[model samples]
Target chain A: MEKTIIVNAKSKTYNIEIIDHGLKKLREKVQTVWSPRKVAVITDENVGPLYANQVQRQLNAGGFVVEVLTVPAGESSKSWMNLEKIIQQLAEKHFGRQDGILALGGGVVGDLAGLAASIYLRGIALIQLPTSLLAQVDSSVGGKTAIDLAAGKNLVGTFYQPDLVLIDPTVLLTLKSRCLVEGYGEIVKCAALVGGDFWQLTGQIKSPQAIMRNANALIEASVRFKAQIVAADETETRRRQLLNLGHTLGHAVEQAAGGRLFHGEAVAIGLYQLSRLFEQKKLTAVGVTEQISTRLQAVGLPLSDDELGTTDFYRALKHDKKIKQQQLTMIYLKKIGQPEFYCYPIKQVIGWLQQELSQKKS
Target chain B: MEKTIIVNAKSKTYNIEIIDHGLKKLREKVQTVWSPRKVAVITDENVGPLYANQVQRQLNAGGFVVEVLTVPAGESSKSWMNLEKIIQQLAEKHFGRQDGILALGGGVVGDLAGLAASIYLRGIALIQLPTSLLAQVDSSVGGKTAIDLAAGKNLVGTFYQPDLVLIDPTVLLTLKSRCLVEGYGEIVKCAALVGGDFWQLTGQIKSPQAIMRNANALIEASVRFKAQIVAADETETRRRQLLNLGHTLGHAVEQAAGGRLFHGEAVAIGLYQLSRLFEQKKLTAVGVTEQISTRLQAVGLPLSDDELGTTDFYRALKHDKKIKQQQLTMIYLKKIGQPEFYCYPIKQVIGWLQQELSQKKS
Candidate 1:
């Protein structure tokens, strides 16, 4: 199956192609966009041994010189230390503006390699080959590349779009059960925004095995929803803010949990919290909360903040980079299909969250 | 007097304003664009003692929480070590996304601080107040912020445009004589590209004092020329490459010289070499070489490569990042008014340069 999403960014227009087992045509598909003499395939330790050589060999056989750069696996790899190391490797290998970088792993590899490509020789061609369902559906298509900082997550980054995004869902079959489950939160969030066929499609997914079986359809629906939002606003100014639906509280929850909760789990809890807040304010209908909560539970995602530290979560929220001029702008759904951004004083939101946390504890 | 040139980049549109004493209204003008809570005024050691306090006080009086970040003077300050230090300072001060950075020095300070701002909290507001003639005319106008690498200069950077550029030509009077003279090479290159009035205007300049005396007109012309090219092509893909009329060979020359030759001086040498090459190729008129040589001599710029190692220059050229697939794309003077880009094999250019150097020695 093939789907090409036309992301009409102001710099240039590119596509995101969703294909099954597309590694065979890696060179042919890449050649359609650029004729780079040399290409660097960047992956992480976990994904490198499995797929890096195969991808590099395929490109080499197609008459292009190819090399592989592998970083350690996981989120810690997204750091300035690793960024500098990767840049040194690219420099030592003499990757120039005419060359390209193939980000061939999960979100960590994709982000770090994409950022490296964005700065190498002031900018070069980047082709993303996202392996995980999370990467294929969310991170790869948006063009937001970043590395974690001592200050916060994604504190240092640039909005650099890729020349092309290749999503091969077949790779998800090899992902850990936890990884597969974590990806559903984002897919469900995307479904909430898209609201129609995708919602029905996500609703049909009952377990982790179902996610693997329906990975193609789920990935397509999620990416299509995000692509439309990104096409409208490449940089998150107003319209694109809706995509951050559960992210504000989600980030706080994740930070508070400190590696215990997966990103999607935190986001699932964030979505549940936001729905309740909206219903309390009468901004959303009463059962909008129950509807979203039910969907989250159906997917086996965490629906309540039972284990999270309330104070730590609130503290994390305070340092969030998105907080502007003492006010926090949050995205919440009015109903299933409609999403809106609302601004409230930081103190007000903290008070609300504090009350909710205490009430739940009692 | 003030002139505002609009730079329509893909990210957003910003204005480059050339003013007699732009620093006076720095706070008021900055407030017009953003209501940043706290602002960091970054400068070099040379410029900080002179203007950091003044700029910070002005902003403070205008109700902004202002602080200063001063790095050591000169090009060495544009290093990864300093970048890490600057980022650490920003984090320590709790500079959040709603804050801004004011780059208050020459090219080095502007480039470093601009880059810092581009990555802080994923990106924050940046207002450039160029305090040197070279910065006012060249670096400050284009939003190309970068830091140097061990491999080469500007091997790592991003196309992050500033929110505003404020040029204060009066500050040039306080610059070192050598610094003041170095600024002219870029001015003359801009004059050559603009032709007609600017060319005639450049020919009338007799000395460093004359450049300082006519600083307003000279700075405006140079900035306008660059702004036009940058506006047409925000990323140096096509039309914008013309602005690099002398930079290909210039970078190699600069690299070979280490810290001995300034950027503009190397550019002057590159311009002279390119004119002679064009003349020999019959691409330019017969006396075009002499005309450019005469103009360069009149401005007290170098007319020939002296004290410059020919072998080292060729080796540096070989390692240049701009060389694409073994071919170097160079911009040369087709005539006084016209500039063109052409691709030549590296070996062919090295052979041509070698022959020319040998013939000159004899």
Candidate 2:
């Protein structure tokens, strides 16, 4: 099924083909979609060492001056210094009017590279080749490219639409265990949102090997779930807020952990918390919290909030960019394949956190 | 006079209106153009001290929350660190999607504030109230906003277009002598490029006071000339390149002087150098260079390359952003109101620079 996510807000927005083996029509893709002379492919050390040459060769073969710029892998590299260097290089290389860039790595590379593509020459044609599971499933399609500042993650960035996204399902085979589990958290979020079809498919993905090895089923199910959410609200204005089911607390968990917690592991804990809160509100039935915890743990994710040290959890939550109008908007899982967004006023949310702290002390 | 400057490559663009007593329509002018909740007016110490309060009052009277964000006046503030701080402040202040920003200072404020507007809440509405003469004519109109880095100026920035440009001619009344002359360089460049009825006006204006004293004549002439050139070619692919007449060497002059050389002064010298070169090419004969040089000199401008030290001339020229295919393209003057772009091969341009240097040494 080819469903296109139309970001109708911008002047130039193209269709996003949500299907497996999307990278097969590489040359035709470029000709049909973009009209760029030069393409700077920014990747990470890990992905660059593996697939940089192949991607570069393909782009070069498709008639582009493909320049491979690689940085070391990790969340830390998404810095101002790195962004400035890439901008200078882009200008020095004369990546101008007809020229653009291809972001070829996981989330950090996709983010920083996309940001570079966004600002350089003021919005160039961008193509995403997301190597990591995290990027391919979530970050790549969202049109959100940002670099982190010292204060927190993604403090400095912009929302720039990419010309095309190239997802090679074959690349997921190289992901580590931690990466695989984190990727599945988003996959599970998809399952939880899209209903019986996605939930049944995710339940069938019991074995870690089955989930990791299976590309076609994963891509189809995951892309469909994501395509629906993105199609409805591309800018995250209304209905799109529900897609952040576990991310509110999960993002804070990652921050508190100081980049220690893999995004999926943190999300699992967020799902657990959200489910419990939903149960308290009668939005979810009894045992939903346990189901979420069990499912997440089975998928090799930590479902407990024990990892988030009590002291910095509240501090981290304050910096959450998603909070607008002094409300700590939380998305909760009402049931499997069901999510709901409810604005918990900041005072109440902070009070709940304090209650949790008191219970721990007692 | 009613011509529109179509920003060739980009999606969004608005008109550059240069009218007398623009302050009267300040409310209607901004509201009609951009209906933002909050206008994040980034001013500097100098401009803010003078006009920030008045602008704030005007916007407030129009029922808008005008937050005045002030930074120290200079080029040094245009940095990633400052950008980070501004983003943090905007986020912390709860500047939402409905909110936009008003850039109320000169180039530095416009660049920094416009860049902020481009990124904040994934880009919001931007309005320019450029105070400096350089900013009033140039930066306010073009959507090219950037911050400088150690490597170069405007190294990391975006082409974020503004919704409206509020060029209050009254602001020019308070401008220092040196800065006012700097603005004239842009006017002269605009005059030289679109030489027809307005072309004849350039040679006639004997004093800087001619521009400073009269609002209607100066605004009408400057706006028409620039707007036409911009209308012909917005993104500087061909026709717009003529606007950069003296900038090739002018930017180097500013960098060498450590921000001492006002932008207009550099252009004045750059124009002189270019006019002399045109004379050598038999492009502009009959004492065109002398005529233009004397007027600019009378208005307190450095009109000759002979005065500027020879050191770092080659190095500065190399770093120019307009270089293409290893050639240094220059926008030269053929007459008082006409500019011609010559994509001189780098070797020849360097040869010319050495000749100029030797001539100056003698």
**Among these predicted structures, which one has the highest lDDT?**
1
Tell me the lDDT of model 2 at B2.
Answer: 27
Computed on C-alphas against the true complex, the DockQ of each candidate is 0.73, 0.28
Q: For residues B1-362, could you state the per-residue lDDT of candidate 1 as single tens digits?
A: 88888788766789888777788877777877877479888988899998888788889888899888889998998888888888888877778877888899988988888888887766888999988877888888778888988777888877778888988788887998888888898888888888889988888888888999889898888887887888788888888888888877788889888878888888888888888777898987787677667677776888556634377788788877768889888877777888877899988988888887778877
Error of 1 at A115 (Å): 0.9
Lowest lDDT sum, 10 consecutive residues, model 2 chain A, at A1-10
How many angstroms is the interface RMSD of candidate 1?
Answer: 1.4
Model 2: per-residue lDDT, tens digit, A1-362?
Answer: 34444444343455555445555556666667765377888988888988778776777788878888888899988987788778778867766555778887889998999898887756667888787777877888767888886667776678777877767776677788778778888877767777686667776666567776665566666765665666666667788787788888788887888877887777777777767766876888787677666667776777765545376877878767676556777877666666666887776887876776466556
lDDT of 2 at B288: 79
Superposed Cα deviation of residue B7, candidate 2 (Å): 9.6
What lDDT does candidate 1 reach at residue B262?
87
lDDT of 1 by residue, A19-118 (tens): 8888777877888887857888899999998898889888887777888888899999999898898888888888888888999998888889888888
**CA RMSD per model (angstroms):** 1.7, 5.2
**What is the Cα root-mean-square deviation between model 1 and the actual structure?**
1.7
